[model samples]
Target: MTKTIVNSWNEWDPLRHVIVGRADDCHIPPAEPALDAKVPEDSDMRGQWGRRPQDTIDRANELLDGFAALLEGRGIRVDRPTPIDHAQPATTPDFHTDSQFGCMPPRDVLLTVGSEILEATMSYRCRWFEYLNYRPLMQRYFEEDPRFRHESAPKPRLTDADYHPDYLSDKIGNAKRLEWAAAKHFVTTEEEPLFDAADVLRFGRDLVVQHGFTTNLKGIEWLRRHFPDHRVHAVNFPGDPYPIHIDATFTPLRPGLILNNPQRRLPDAQRQMFERNGWDIVDAAQPAHNSPPPLCYSSTWLSMNVLVLDPKTVCVEASEVYQMEQMDKLGMNVIPVALRDAYAFGGGLHCCTADVYREGQCEDYFP
Candidate 1:
């Protein structure tokens, strides 16, 4: 009999809970009493909530650990922590370690170097250019073919911020705009920015074919390399000022089932990719008046930042975001954790944490 191993958040064993590697500068400043008063309006994505750095860290850790505990409570076994050294130069071994956000397909384990970590850095070079870890994960994959290539191309030219601040809440409105403008300025600046005009036009013509967000490229590549056989789906960003990550509109709960807002248009051709694979795609409907744009805040707000505790359960921030009364109709258990500060860092639970591997799934060598 085939063992149908269900990798659900709820079924995860807390004893196996571990952080794969540590990012040097990813931690928030320790919450302090006086620092609360010093919250810069620029960085103060957290409005009204006056938690200091330590408080923020404590709160984030509480939620992270709590989620792990929830998994442990469910008898799921987690793995030991893996340490990734950030002190080493990004290119010392594989120059692309810093930007792993969307490189791989989602939820796949990679066998790179002892430092098998990889990420995509932006340049006029190859679009899918990759920076592999020092040790190299799969020598076979590397030796097999040149999936990633380097090309000599001109850097992209950026454009002024086209996204207006119309939909943001009063508190984060100005800050979000500033952030978007800053990103736009950099991308359209004299030097290499996040995007350029020609690049932007190309990306818009076909969001799936376009490449942006170097950090997310890391995640994308990881998914691709690790789960080579899995069917991957990404949404088209018809809107401007690129969404931060793929999770912006698409997140998988089970193999084929995903939770997504309807604003993201998945053409029939793309939808068929899942259906043809014997996967069932479920759409988490949006509110009658609710729409996603200007960075699809729902991607972040809906606790899309949260991660799956199990195939049927998820852990999210205990805030208005997850308070959607209509979610119960979807038939999944929601666990809420306090993550206000973490959410401010442009990520929440899922964003901050990376799922290294799923338990009980052994991948055999195909090639």
Candidate 2:
């Protein structure tokens, strides 16, 4: 048997290996039901669909390369995915998309658990084939680690029935969106199991998932059945009008600490587990920027989407001054990384990377 290489139970263990995403051949996908619902009514990307600007792609690559190098400098092994031409359309019997989104954020495509790497059944039609970009790495892990379990979730049909027609209108204001969110009426319907890997947060024996636009109640149920050994909890942040992924909303920094977006507080009903476990859920500092970088799908709360290197060290965006100060006050060694240019491609530190190996066994943090 080969040496163990694929293993990670939680997000904050000491990092030994990781996969950082690339910004090459990224695209703004054509508007679709579930995706369009998340786009703010006035967003610049409302109707645009094409390859991203060449200059912006180049700049983003530079930052990503520098980030990989920075990880190498700290003695952490970093791997990168082979980019596929996102210009090709994804055609299936049930659906067809004109173009595909890029692999700029590996977190949305791959979920890492103890001894396993599960490819997510992403909700968007444009992202159906995104897992191809990481196939090479998966093959490598399978060959090198005898214990590595490379798994893929069941592919969702993603037909028209998968989306709720109520969210298809472009005129739905933020107030209306918030009301819908509060009522747990997300864009994705309960027709199928649909989820993005970014919607899940692993804490040893517990997997916390967000029930939002990219993930439906059925998706959470699927996760619960799939990982029978772990406690799967479905959480909702009704305050976020455009709730997508959980990284920007609820971030677990260490064993007993979590930085939650102030605007998207976890409801009291959902706080029982954490509070009972003696955890401290602190409101994250405000983002330094008023708006996200151009053509970005995520909000400025990416400021809280930090990458935890062990429990004492974290990498924060260089421009997020308030976030840095907060991390410092919380007794973290903050490493400033310049990654705002790449925000247009996908997300921040945590969003752009996926875990391969962290230096620890699965220890139940909530038990």
Candidate 3:
């Protein structure tokens, strides 16, 4: 069973095999310090907590299954995680939650760098045990690939000390939030290493991490020490008040190009490396919808969270007309897929998948 399977250096490579998450048994986890701070002030999801509506779950599953089939049709090996009992509450000595988050977005929990898959120390209490959803696949890969290094970060004790009390209020408007963001005052403190896998973007010999609500300075430091061979850079986008994951904010379409949300432009200091290395960071197109789907945690900027099939091709949400047009103009063949109904489950296309094998070797793009 020892055959080559797990290997991926950076995003935008020609993906050969991947894991697509399922929407079954998705839930609306109870509001906690870190989770509540991320919920928009006017979001209808406020005070909502329980298993998601069954009809919505079904619709989401349908879309997810169809997406898997589409990827398989294109000759990519697609794997799905076995759904666990998501209704069960996740409790530990340090903390306890009424319910657990779903496994619909594997990208948020699993960081696949080269032959290793590291489970992130997620900041949200409800999502602390989310890695259980993918343990089976990780085991299988370990058995099948001799070089597959399945690793997990130290589980963080998400006690009260980990969050800032000021963000607990429900009325922190965009203005105050913007000011706080500019000062790098996020909800999660430096008490421990906490990060969502989606916050870290892998470049050859370099890892770019977002320092925001979900990922703190300590988490990036942990990643730096964990991967001593790679150069780690911590970046902050002052324009994003609720920055959690980087996929929707900064997307690498290929080696020499990236799509950034205009609302959260990368600071000039952070852009120097890319500019010096001849990389073009273009502003992503505005979303087609004025708002995100009901009960969704992501912003309207999920339009940029596209799945790159290869350097020349990408899969975008079907209704994201402006994004598709932008992709087309950027020389990438666009494949539009309907996925808005599934946004509430976790996220868009790219957020729902984790890379397993991409045909390439690690090359220092920044050097």
Predicted model with the maximum lDDT: 2
lDDT of 1 by residue, 12-123 (tens): 2221322221122222222221121223333433233222245544554555456556655765543222323322322232122222212111111221111122232233
Q: On residues 268-304, what C-alpha lDDT tens digit does candidate 3 reach at each position?
A: 9999999999999999999999999999999999999
The lDDT of each candidate is 0.34, 0.94, 0.93
Task: Write candidate 2's Cα lDDT for 1-367 as tens digits.
Answer: 2344988999999998999999999999998898898888888999999999999999999999999999999989999999999999999999988999999799999999999999999999999999999999999999888899999999999999999999999998989999999999999999989999999999999999999999998999999999999999999998999999999999999999999999999999999999999999999999999999899888999999999999999999999999999999999999999999999888999999999999888777778
User: Candidate 1: global Cα-lDDT?
Assistant: 0.34
RMSD of each: 11.5, 1.3, 1.1
Q: By lDDT, rank the candidates, best first.
A: 2, 3, 1
Model 3 regions more than 4 Å off: 1-4
Q: For model 1, how big is the CA root-mean-square deviation?
A: 11.5
* After superposition, candidate 2 runs with Cα above 4 Å error: 1-4
Question: What's the residue-level lDDT of 332 in candidate 2?
Answer: 95
Itemize residue pairs with steric clashes in candidate 2.
none
Error of 1 at 241 (Å): 3.3
